[model samples]
Target: MATFAELPDSVLLEVFSYLPVRDRIRISRVCHRWKRLVDDRWLWRHVDLTVYTMRPKVMWHLLRRYMATRLYSLRMGGYLFSGSKAPQLSSALMRALGQKCPNLQRLCLHVADLTTVPIASLPRTLKTLELHSCEISMLWLRKEQDCSVLPLLECIVLDRVPAFQDEHLQGLTRFRALRSLVLGGTYRVTETGLDAGLQELSYLQRLEVLGCTLSADSTLLAVSRHLRDVRKLRLTVRGLSAPGLAVLEGMPALESLCLLGPLVTPEMPSPEEILASCLAMPKLRVLELQGLGWEGQEPEKLLSRGLPHCMVIVRACPKESMDWWM
Candidate 1:
C-alpha cells in the first residue's frame, strides 16, 4: 500500500502547490520531509500574505522564512491598524525584501503605511506596483545613484491613495518604460499636472482614470496627442460632453473604451451624442457604459442604432462593470 508520505519529493511538492496556505502550514507539521517540501521556494513564488492577520512578529517570521528569497510576486499588508508598530515593521520588512528578493518583479500593498520605507531602499527589479490606500509619495520612484529606482516598472495602480497627487504623476513620468497606469479615486491630479506628466509617457498603452474630476478632459487630450500608441482607455469624469470626447478620436490605435460615472448629468452629452462620438472612432472595437441611466432611454435600444461590429456592455452597477479591469 502506497501512502501519501511514500510519494517522491517532486510529486509531494506538486500536491502541496494546490493546497491553501493554511492547509500547507498544517500539513508541514505532519512530518519533517513534508515540512521541507512545503518550505520550498517554488511553493512561495507568488505569495499573498494579505490572507493572514499581519502583526509585527508574524510579518517578521513570514519574511524570514517564506519570503527570504526566490519571491517573484508578493501581495502584503492590511496591518494599517498596527499604529506605531506599522512603520517600524514595514520599514524592516521592505529592507529585508530588498536584500533577500533582488529579483522581485510584482508587488501589491493594501492599507500598509509606507511612510517609513526609504526611497532608495525600494527593490529596483519591480515591473508592476499596485498600492491601495497606502500613504507614500512619488519620490519613492525617483532615480537614485544615476539609475532609475524601478527601471523595469511597466504597470502601476494607485487606488484610493490620497497622497498621490499631480506632482507625483510628474515624478512618475521619469519611468519611461511605463505601459499601463490606473488612477482610481485620486482627486488631486488636475489638468496642469496631468498634461505635464502625460507628455512623457510616450509608450503608454492602457490608461484608466476613474472617479476623477472633469478637468481630466485636458489629461485625455494630452493622452491623445502624446500617447498615440494607447489602445484602451477608461474614464469616469462628471461630464464628458461631445467636445471633450472629440479628444479621443485623435487616438489612432484606440480599441476599447469604458465610460463610467453619471454620463447622463445635465452638463454631459446625451446618449445619442455619446453614441455618435463613439461611432466616429474608427478603431474602437468595444464600448462599455456603466452606471449611466437616462430618462426615457433604453440602453439596449441605443446600442441597436448602430455599432454592429463593436461589443457593447451595459451594466447598472458601476462596481460590477469595473470588475472587468479593477
Candidate 2:
C-alpha cells in the first residue's frame, strides 16, 4: 500500500481540497512539507467557508494566509452574519479580501445587507454575483458610478431582497453581455416596476420570478413577443387569467415552466380559454401547479379528456374538493 508520504503532491493537494477549509488548515500543521502543500494556490481557488460558523477565527486566519493568490470564487455562509458582531467582523473579513483577492471573479453573499460588501475591493474580472437577503436598495443599485466598478458583470441572482426597481436596471443596461437573471421573493416589487424592469434586460435568455404580483397575461405576452429568445421561465401566478394564458401561448420556445400559486377563477376569462391554452403548449415538459382548486365540474375527467398528452404533473388542492384521477 502507498504510504501518505509516498503519494505525489498533486494527489495530496486533491485529497486536501475535499476536506473542509478548517480541516485543511489543521492538517497543514501536521508537518512542514504538508504545510507548504496546503498553501498551494490551486487549493484555495474556490473558497467555500460555509462550514466554519462555529470557528470563524479560523476563516480569518486562512484568509490572511491566502488573500493574494488570484481567488476565483468565494462563498461565505452560516451564522457569520446572524451573530451580534456580524456588522463589524464581516466588514473586516470583506476588507481583507478586497485588499488581497484582487482577481475574484464570482462572489456569493448570504448576509443581511450590503453595507459592508467591501465593494471597492471587488475584482475587475467579476461576472457572476448572488445576493441572499442583502440590504441593498434600488437607489443604491441604480448608482451608475458605483456600477462602473463591475463592467464585466453578467449574471445576477437576487434572492429574498426587499427593494428593487426599474431604474436599477438602467445601471445594468450597459452590460451587453448580461444574459441570465433571477428575481425571487418579489412581494415588494410593484407590477409596473416588475414589467419595466423585465423590459430592460435586453439580452435575457432565462428568467425566474418566485413571488411576483404582475399582470400575468399581459406581462407574459409582452415578454413572449419582445423577449422571444427566452428559453427558460419559472413563475408563480396567483390568479391565472385568459390574457395571461394568451401571453404563455407566445412563448413558442418554452421548454420548462413551474407555475406555482393557484389559478384565478370566476374572473376575466372563462375556464375554457385557460384549458385551451394549456392544451396548445407544445414544447412544455415539466409543469408544477401548487394550491390549485378547480371550481368546475368533473375537473379530473375534463383534464383527462383534454390535457392527457401534455406530460403534465397536476397537483390539485383539497380546498377545490376535486377528486384525484390516476
Candidate 3:
C-alpha cells in the first residue's frame, strides 16, 4: 500500500496548498520528502499574511524565506500592535522581493508602513497594486525617477493614502498603459490634478473616483475628452449639482455607470433625468444610483416601469435607507 509521501509531487503540491501557511510549515517537519514537496513553488503562488497581526521582523523573515520566483500575488499587513505601532516592510525584504518574485503581478499592503521600502525595489512585473490605509514618508511619495518605475503596471488602487496628492497623480500620468485606476479617500487631489492625470490615459477602461472635490460636469467632460474608452465608472459627487449632466453620449462601449450623489438639491438634475440619459446610450447595461435617498417618488415610479434594455440599480451604501457616504 502507498503512503501519503508516496503520492506524486503534482498531486501533493496541489493538495498541500489548501493547508494554512503555518500548518504547511508544521507538516514540513514530518519528513525531508514532505518538506521538499511543501516547498514547491506552486504552493506559494498566492500568499496572504493578513489573517492576523504579525511583527515587522517576523513578516520579513517569512517573506525572505518563501519569496518564490513563481509568486503571482502577495497581500500583507493587517493591524499593528504586536509590540509595534507600525509594521514595516524593510528595504532588504523589498530587494529580495524584486530579485525573487519576477512573476509577481499583484501586491497589496494594508495598514503597513512603507517608509523604508524603495519604489525602485518593486518588481517590474507588477500589474496590480493596492495600498489601503498605508503610511509613507513625504520623500517616498515625492520621489521622481528619470525612467518608468513600474512600466507594465495596469491597475492601481490608493485608498486612505493621505500623502497621495496631485504630484502623485501627475506622476501616474507617466504610466499611460494602465487599464484600471481607483483613487478613493484621497483628500489632497483636486480637479486640476485629476484632469492633468487623466489626460493621457486613452486606454483606461475602468475608473472609480471617490473622496474628492471634483464637480460632476467637469469630471464627465474630462472623461469624455480623454478616457472615452472607459466602460465602467463610479464618481462620487459633492456640493451642488446642476440640472444638466455631461453623460457619456458617444461612448457606445460603456456598460456600467454608478453615480454616487450630492443629495437632491433644488438646482440638481433629477435621478430620473440621469436614468433617461443612461437609457439612451447605445450599449449601456447598468445604471446604479447610490448614497442619495429618494427625494421624490417619480424616480422610483419610473424605476418600477423600467425598460427592457438597461438595468436601473438603486442600492444603499451604508446598509438600507441609512445615510452613509463613502
Candidate 4:
C-alpha cells in the first residue's frame, strides 16, 4: 500500500491542489518528496499568500526564478500586510509579481490598509480582481495604466474598501467586458459611484453594495432602478427603511438578493417590511437575510410570503421562520 508520500508527483499534485493552500503547504513540511513537489512551479502555479511564511524578499526571489511561468492567480489575506515591514515587503512583492507573473489572470488582495496601489506594476493579462477591505484609490485604476483592452476580465469584488471617488468609478468604464462587481464597505460611497459604474458597464449582470450610506430615500430607491439589468444584488446596512425596501420592489430580474445587517437599533426595520417589499420580485430565486428580526415583533407575516422556488438563508435569523425562509 503506497502512502501519500509515495504517490507520484503528478498524482500527488492533483490531490494537493484540492486541499486549501494552507493544508498543502503543511503537508509539504512533512518530508522531502512532498516539499519538493509542492515547491514545483506547476504546484505553486496559483499561490495563496495566506499559506506562505517566507520573507517578502524570499518570495520575490522564488517567484522570479522557480514560479514565474507557473503563477496565474494570487489570493492574499489581510494578515500578509499586517507585519511591521509590510511597506517594504508589499512593495517588493508587487514589483516582483508584476515583472514575473505576466500570464496572471486573477488577483485577490484583501489588505485592509493603503491609500494607493502600484497599478502600473500589475500585469496586463489580469482578468479578475477581488479587493476586500483594501485601501485602493479609484484614481490608480483610472490614471495609472496604459492598457485599453482586458477582454477576459469579468469580476471585480471591492468589499468594504474605503478608496472610491466619483472620478475613480468613472475609470472602471474602461473595462468594457466587466460583468460582476461586489462593493461593500463603510465608505461614504454615493449613489453616483454605483450609477457611474453601472451605466458604463454595458454587460454587467451582478452588483452588490453592502454598508453604504446612500444619501436619502430617493437616491437609495434610485439604486436598484439604476442597476436594472443586475440579476444578483446584495444591499446591507445598519438601518433599512420603508423607502429602501420600496426600491427593491422594482428589481424584476433579480434572482439572488441579500439584505443583511445587525439587528441592534431602534431604526432597524422589521423582517416583514423587507419581505413585503420584496414579495413582488417574480424572478427572485435566492433570498438571504442576516440578523432578521425586530426587538419584540413576530415574523410570521414575513415567513408566510416566502417564495418556494427561492433558496433562502436566514442566518442568525429567528428560528420561527426557518420553515418559511429555509
Number of the predicted model whose lDDT against the real structure is largest: 1
Candidate 2 accuracy as lDDT: 0.64
Please give the CA lDDT of all the candidate structures.
0.75, 0.64, 0.73, 0.64
- Candidate achieving the largest TM-score: 1
Q: Give the root-mean-square deviation of each candidate in angstroms.
A: 4.3, 6.8, 4.7, 5.8
Model 4 weakest 10-residue run by lDDT: 317-326
Instruction: Please provide, for model 1 over 1-326, each residue's C-alpha lDDT reduced to its tens digit, 9 standing for 90 to 100.
Output: 88996788888888887776668788989989888988888888887877666567766776777766768998887577766645333555676777888768899998877766765566778899899878874556543333466688899998888777877776776676789999887878887767777777777899998776635466568787788888999887565667888777646789998877654556676667777877778898898877777444476568755787789887664555454234
Give the higher-lDDT candidate: 3 or 4: 3
TM-score of 2: 0.69
Worst 10 residues of 1 by lDDT: 138-147
- Candidate 3: tens digits of C-alpha lDDT, residues 1-326: 87776788888888888886778888999989888877787888988877756676766666667756768998887453344565556776767777877888999988877766767777778899898888766655443653477888889998878788877876775564688999877878887877877885667899887656566667776787788778988877554254335457657678888777645456565666665666566778777777666655667558646645668777555452232144
Cα TM-score of candidate 1: 0.81
Candidates 1 and 4 compared: the better one by lDDT is 1
Q: How many residue pairs clash in each candidate?
A: 0, 3, 0, 2
Each candidate structure's TM-score, on Cα atoms with residue i matched to residue i, is 0.81, 0.69, 0.78, 0.74
- 278 Cα displacement, candidate 3 (Å): 0.5
